[model samples]
Target: MQENFEDQESVEIQVGSEENLKIFIVNKTLLREASNYCRRRFALELKYEEEPIILNGFEPLIFEIFLQWISNPAPRITYDPDRLPQEPWLSNAATAWLLGKKLQCSDEFDKYALSQFVQNCAFMTFGPWELIEKEATTGSLSRFSDHWVAWNYRLAGPGRNEYSGLRAARATLTAPVRDPRTFDIEHWYSDCGKYMRPRCLHDPITRLEKLEEAKRPKPIPPAEWGRSTELRRERPQ
Candidate 1:
């Protein structure tokens, strides 16, 4: 009797930010504290208002990430003094340290294990979608929020090996198309009347001068009939 044979491919897979993942796994609380400190100091720039105003695209899961990030920041990426921004995200190393610290503080589970859970959340919440070409589809924030919240439920542990499975399950979840530039340009032109004036280019403030001049009557031009008499008195013209 001949036996039927089936071939299947098994491949090792990699996912998410390895550096962040490693750091987070190594320590949790230290990362949390550092991130929190950075947020309190630099929070002004990150917010449209004193509190971060949730916009159309802002995800609640991202807010959770934000809370974590504020609690523990990544360390400074750049050491070159001149090139650094006025403020920096906690460095990847610093974050790793913080993550390690967080792991030490919490009894919820192994710090490394929880880091993996948080990492899973981060990956699912912020992962970039592959390029696909198709008809555009629009979605509401509520729909997006609900989807992420569901994903959040799946992060039971690091070794669960669920990322790929979840991704496969949601294979039809398409990335949102950006608004077309042409429409934006048209909208700008429509609003141009609010900001534009038909004034001299060389001196934009010339409009103010023109207004002042208008308030004072211009000296009347000499009459055409008196031109010859005035010219005669000045010179025999």
Candidate 2:
């Protein structure tokens, strides 16, 4: 949903250089929900009725999406810049993109909030591994490494589709590394790959063949008594 800023509580944020700087008015709630930095700043200003908050060293477009996410009627909806047709796992990419933007803010509280967002969103979406793989591919380098490793500790959590978890892991292992987000992916691959391979289902062709083989009945062997009877009949009395 497009948020109509009119008639809502607004805060002026100073962005860019004085000549290049632009003042943008944003809704207090939108900022608070998306970023802890925005939340705290808004809290102080709301209490004191302070001057416009000055924020420097950030791009307008990134901030625009950051604002848009929280303001969205369907934040649960994955954001794709191209608005490409989504696959079942497309949310993974969207989550990765959102968390990446969160990292750019360079706020400790905001970072924590984004991490929490990922955790909660992953559970709700029933796609933790997709989120994990997405983190490696899209999230910040050092942060995502730690986050990806943390997933092994959360292996095959109940109520999740185990095959989907393994499939996501399969995607992560095979997907090309994007630095610095995935600089360590290769390093982590050997071990995580070992864990995932067995659990991930065989490809459709292999599975179908296996199923057919399993369904085919085995032929019954002839009775063992016939050979024994002939030997006994030939024996001298």
Candidate 3:
């Protein structure tokens, strides 16, 4: 019997510059499904028999995260205290989001990265608005930045209009607010009145619960007698 393409680890991805180049081995089927960029590249080739693909100007760490996203069953963007400090995590998340766009990664992967970035910003006293503005120069990212600024202004409310950037017009807007020196997740969580947790934080728990509910067979409706009877008749013993 012939081996399945999905099971073959035939793709080698080389990320980053010559000085700090790193190679990643990935399954061709999974890589093709996860990234449109890779799919197109593979299609163009007459015969791609384990040819190593080179990706220039990419952070090796970010690229690794992309690989993990495709390989794992349930991939998540999490902050690791040991590998990275809290402040840099936000920046990394932004980088990951940009990387996803560049690679034309699946919607799920891009959404997760963006959600992490937004949630990370919400937890902090202030965000790396300058960096976000700098990075989001065009396309969907630019629109996202604009929406983020508007959203923050609404959350800040009338009395808490201390942020100068928020007062500016959309076109003139630079950074949403000034950057903070430090961010304490515990402190942010504790102050419920001042800082409400973003929906993204609770999403994982709620999403799983919803998925479990969806998986289980729903009970026949008691209110609709005819429909219930029909359903019961249709069901196999």
Candidate 4:
């Protein structure tokens, strides 16, 4: 018979290493619903209640944030550097994003974490660039390379330049054709707009060319000019 996870009120989950282990008692139904990793683990285990579910290789704080998100209907997980000792807000947010990726959390969770990461990158001067580079190179955060490149363009810090090759590849793959006539002003300010700009990860000469092209005005069509001239001639003083 298939077990009904809803009947269980809560389950104990142990995280972190033995030296600094932390236990979390969370609603089993919510946990199962929120995390595919937890859901699969619970489904496969016949006697989950006999012992605390061991979740290794995760920090206590990261798991706490994950639990808080799963438990509350409206989670308020903000980026505050003081929230965690010795860890910067950017690192904390990045760790949460990685945790969400590992757990295969809900789409809401993914978006929330990703947004936090992006916002932190934009506001802060420095971030966990080494972690980001490692993850992107290993394909862990490969899908978010566009975002990384976009923000890097805006910041242009020294640390980020170390991994220019990786970002250059992303920039090249996502670079759009330069057409001044069809240029979008609002889009030029958007996140993807960074990739579309001449100042992106490419040759300086090429970037200058693209900037000049964007500055050039579109020519008026001959038919439109003829109509305007005819209208002016027919108009009474």
Candidate 5:
């Protein structure tokens, strides 16, 4: 599978005081290796981009995991105007962590600790996507922590104005959904559901509705395979 996509060839890492770390100019291999490091240490997946060309020599970035502590001795809210219009859902994890920190909840503490772990592991989280027809398409393998942040914020409120790239992708499909008849879950499943949690099918009716798409079966038949050769040939040369 690694052979099929471009692999990052190199990367540089830097550590700082109080979780002020930075990762500059990284490639796919480096990103994967760093994510594996987080997985081993924190039991969490570090989302990232899949395209090697898109990630080639990406600029090093800084993330402040301990910023919320500098003044209040814990994680606090700080919004960046540069990162707008806010998505309220993006604050879920961070807020949960903040609450756990305040109430001393063990589970929340664990999640908070893992969040810190991922942050310390990769000071900043960003991703690359394939822009097709004015839409952003993320890769399945990519770990999108920033998107999570956006969702957390979106769920947090009406006071903020930030948006999650992940939500934006979903909104893209659902936005102009006037008729709902033009809706096609088959393509949606192929593009997104392939990476969703299995528990997503908890509702039998929902499962049945989705299964009606023909591609929702456990194993897709070989005949359903599309023009891969043509797709591959069209890739950036």
Candidate 6:
């Protein structure tokens, strides 16, 4: 199957930038069923354009994974922490989910990808809470942070700003959402519960719990130690 896509090379996709241009030779048939974006892109007559399909707003690796998954549904991720890289699996899964949203993939495919992403997070939490929280708080991966918190709500439970991203994502299919970081899952539950009843929020623990308060990073204080000593010595010491 891999060989067929590579050897046949019916479609030519030019990705990356001028300095590091990559030309991926692929089969159109594999991509035909996956996404509307790819379908439309594949349908375009590439003969007229000087460059290959210049897909902006996506990293090349993330885009490649999107292609690989379309070629073979349900990515076969190795859950072995020692073998696998720490960040790629979760970050890539999040990227793919966002890509699916951006492309407006079919409901079935979208749900399937979402399930895979959630499963990845579940597996990740078992390895190291520190890594999971670190990635979650990075805030670089769109729509992923709250879901991580939601998983925490299901697995253990964190109180502050847990469901906000999920709420904002559900609030609109359009752009310009107010503070994507602060929108909570309860708002999403209220608005979108009827259509998509996510179990994490559905059977959520209702206590104001700080699941990892002790593990949370402490902020360093400003320069006060030297000044305090100087004042004490001048006054009485």
lDDT of 5 by residue, 1-237 (tens): 011112355433332333343433334342343233322422232355422122122111211222222212443222232333222223223333332333233332333333342333222232222221122133211222322333344454455333433444443322321211112222222433333222234324456767787675576557434699678778998
Task: Provide the TM-score for each candidate, comma-separated.
Answer: 0.16, 0.36, 0.52, 0.54, 0.20, 0.45
Model 6 scores a TM of 0.45
Predicted structure 3: lDDT: 0.57
lDDT of 6 by residue, 102-210 (tens): 6646554555444445445544444333333444333223233443444444433344433334443332333222222222323322433333223333222312234
lDDT of 4 by residue, 162-213 (tens): 3466554355444444332122222323454444444442334566788899
Q: What is the lDDT of residue 73 in candidate 1?
A: 44
Candidate 1 residues lying further than 4 Å off, grouped into runs, are 1-52, 75-127, 130-237
lDDT of 1: 0.29
112 in model 2: Cα distance from truth in Å? 16
Best by TM-score: 4
lDDT of each: 0.29, 0.45, 0.57, 0.57, 0.32, 0.48
Where does model 5 exceed 4 Å of error?
A: 1-136, 141-150, 164-237
Model 2 misplaced stretches (Cα beyond 4 Å): 1-4, 46-49, 73-237
What lDDT does candidate 2 reach at residue 68?
Answer: 49
Q: Enumerate residue pairs that collide in model 6.
A: 163-184, 163-185, 164-183, 164-184
Give the distance in Å from residue 122's predicted Cα in candidate 5 to where it truly belongs: 9.3
Root-mean-square deviation of Cα positions for candidate 5 versus the true structure, in angstroms:
20.6
lDDT of 2 by residue, 45-128 (tens): 756856876645544444454554455523233222234333322333334344435434333323433333333333344534
Provide the clash count, candidate 1.
Answer: 26
Model 5, 64: alpha-carbon shift in Å? Answer: 22
Q: Root-mean-square deviation of each candidate, in angstroms?
A: 22.3, 15.0, 13.5, 10.1, 20.6, 19.5
Greater-TM-score candidate between 5 and 6: 6
